[model samples]
Target: MRGIIDLNSDELPKIQDKNGALKRPPAGKAAVENLKIDAAILRQSLVAQAGAEIIIYKDPTEAVSTGVLGDVVMMSKQSYFETFEAAPFALVADGGEVTVTPLPINRAAIHVDATGGLQTASGIYGLRFEFSRATLKSYPSIEDAIMHAVVQGLARTGDAVLTAGIMAATPAAFSLAAAAAAGVRMSELRGLVGTAGHGAAIDNNGVLRAAGIAAELSPDLSATIVGSFARSAVMIRSDVEVVVDRTNIDGSLAVTAWAGLQALLPDTTRFWTVAA
Candidate 1:
């Protein structure tokens, strides 16, 4: 028979036997109960997930210009990892067969055993944009005001990126009438375009006069908006929090995107800069 212990003794009850050793419980019952306190502390030790959003807008005028200026290729991250190769030279001959040996000296060096064989060379250039980052912050304010500022800021940033990229890629695409001058004469711009074999029409203020190309030489300055989105992982949470016993509301938005200048032909696309 098992010995029974008194519950009202001065000593606390023990789960062990007389030897002060622990006694095993029944099968699977030997595990201790998990203590889950339902009580909430009065301190502000709680953290709520942040709620922030981001939006992007492109300029309408620039959006329409893409068609005539160039081609804008939307590239995935995987595609961006790949390298761009250009074939600048090819050999052709009138003979039935020809042997060609490429000299290691320079790109222009090519040895051909057959006469009347012609080696034509063209330029091939690779282009890619470096990664960039932008951020916008808003403090506690009217919801409408905060939204307005954010939208405007996003549009301005996008426009600037697109403009800079285009200008960098094709510096000669548009000739500046004068440095540090606004409102250039239409006639001067026309003459410059004509000399370049581009039939671009310009307004009095040197703006592209049309959204479509009037001639083969003219590039349309119109553009279209491409993909734009907020980076959720980098966006800050929009929420009210107490810091140093003061209540404050703050939020931020982060974005990553690619702005491309559209062109009819990728091979013909030139990403160069000319001195002002």
Candidate 2:
């Protein structure tokens, strides 16, 4: 195999432009690793089309909770109690005082510990690609092939996990078989109940900016498909950083992409499945 390129050491060299001054990173700046892959490369997944949030903490060791930390506001009176059933209430005569239970309007509650299956279990999925040093040099660019390969894997498994989480969150699958032609408001369905602040906690999910509800196809569930799940139903968290491992004698390389994924469906009422 042609000589392996060790970007950290071999690829970079020292050079001076007349003044004898170093043209390298100044002070505390670290040279670019050029190893990490952009998440955008594989945006053709169900999670991506579903308006899922991708959380990426800056500090690798910044430390984060396993479960999602979020809150939900009581949209209706039923939302305040354990048995959440939408029932009708009669109006009393004007000024006719009657004894009735106190109300908790727009009650806001926090969920650190998951109640029921509203939050899915957190699992770290790894996508790895191992190739010979000669194979890497053969690509138009090493990062491109690795990024595309690993992300495609992510999108596939990510769907299984996402579908599983939603199925577990609710008793039955949220179907959109008989919905409007235009589909429903993406956020309305997966808002996870009302959020005065919880929305901001998870990057407002991509739905906050997502143009419209997309649909799900047999293969790719991206911005193009007749998308469904159509809003922020699932969340994917990862630094999107690539970890490089060197093979001993073979001089091959393994590029890996890591992510912590979870399905959050506190209240799936607002969501509707879309099929196009």
Candidate 3:
């Protein structure tokens, strides 16, 4: 296992045998495979999900990122809900001349009338992160941290806005919690299929399939009420701006990004808000 050292070369990695050559190891103890360099290190991937988005109005393209910050997209303040009614047929007696009733399958649709009008995605919402130069060097994936911060901050802010809007619009009698209920049911919310649970547990907000109203926890609403809502209830987003400062007054690298976010409810009535 002992071999001559290639000490003459200036490179630390180069074999430094007295002859300036890296001596190859035998296929045993000092073998190159012993390092297992191929699988020695890896960085984890981080992702974030926003419940607010589940109930918000969105275009198909909004989900795909072009590797660019994005551009302004005009969205409508109004949407429509359409549904079909299934009719039942009676089994007619042996039909020689039985007058069979024609099934009348009626159709119904409603204009959601999102009344706020087209909103400007001009509201600024963002966050700044700073790390000392040395700290950034030592820590891995600050990029992921930055992206996650933006998403979570945005989500929390949007939820607060949407919940506040609904609360403000609801009559005082129903807005404030007189007492906590066992749970809010889809039937209670008028067939809306959703649940809001957070500050409280399922005891207050029962479990349901991930549909109806806001399918996920309404970050702010969970504390007071639990109900599902129509999907076209909210709208969100806009352009992004990122600023990086390596030359800091305190020698820390600072990262900052986009603002100009919009959280608008077309029709608050489309939402079901009640005391928990």
Candidate 4:
């Protein structure tokens, strides 16, 4: 005859103090003797299941200028990450639908490209999607798997666009105003005649339009800067003369300018000459 040992409340004191001062265990037997206590399960079994994620938001600011005086337009964006699942796994899932709302762009709004299969905004910078799970494939159905991938792709794509957009606006230092007269003081060379720079002036005629360029700096000075006029008609300040006889005797060229002046030009020209 097979018999099982029972460890009931009688054997494993379920009640508290005689006066019931101590709390009582669940009003049930302790455990079944036939059932073994699995130490491996206590060690390996995931106590909880959770999916943690992080997201970032980037927004580029626009530039507004009036001639030579203008703000160094840059893409300004709100950048931050949202993490899901902290304590109880329910926190992340509690929010039914995760909506990614793109910032409004009256001109060319940033949109998602599903066919692109998760590319970074501007196609540069580091934007990636990470999934963590006890067992990778836990989705109940194929549709669910695709849906998850889509969501992650959208999230990563949005982050890439925003991050790249904002980074694209990071302020840059200016270089030598090429058209400035050779002997002119770098300080006096305020507005540049280059395609870039805050006060950098360019009066390219209908060429930009003809080339399909919008013919204007982006709101944040972050859009494509047209070099159409760079080759043909780009002329520097009248005082600045192009020198055919000039040659770098030192076999090197370095720029020296104030921070303010640097801010007005391209970053490639921020370096200055060490006082020889």
lDDT of each: 0.23, 0.40, 0.37, 0.24
Q: Kindly give the stretch of ten consecutive residues in candidate 2 with the minimal lDDT sum.
A: 74-83
What is the Cα-based lDDT of residue 8 in candidate 4?
Answer: 15
Task: Give me the displacement of residue 173 in model 4, in angstroms.
Answer: 13
Report the C-alpha lDDT of model 2 over 38-82, residue by residue, as the tens digit.
Answer: 243124454555565433222122223453664433221111101
Top lDDT: which candidate number? 2
- Candidate 1, residues 108-168, lDDT tens digits: the string is 1111112212123211111222211222222122222322233223223323333333344
RMSD of each candidate?
A: 29.7, 14.5, 17.6, 32.9
Runs of candidate 3 with Cα error greater than 4 angstroms are 1-122, 171-223, 247-251, 270-273
Q: Sorted by lDDT, highest first, which candidate order results?
A: 2, 3, 4, 1
Output the better candidate (3/4) by lDDT: 3
Return the top candidate by TM-score: 2
Off by over 4 Å in 2: 1-43, 47-90, 96-120, 151-157, 170-215, 219-231, 269-276
Write model 3 residue lDDT over 60-80, tens digit each, in one string: 222323436765443334332
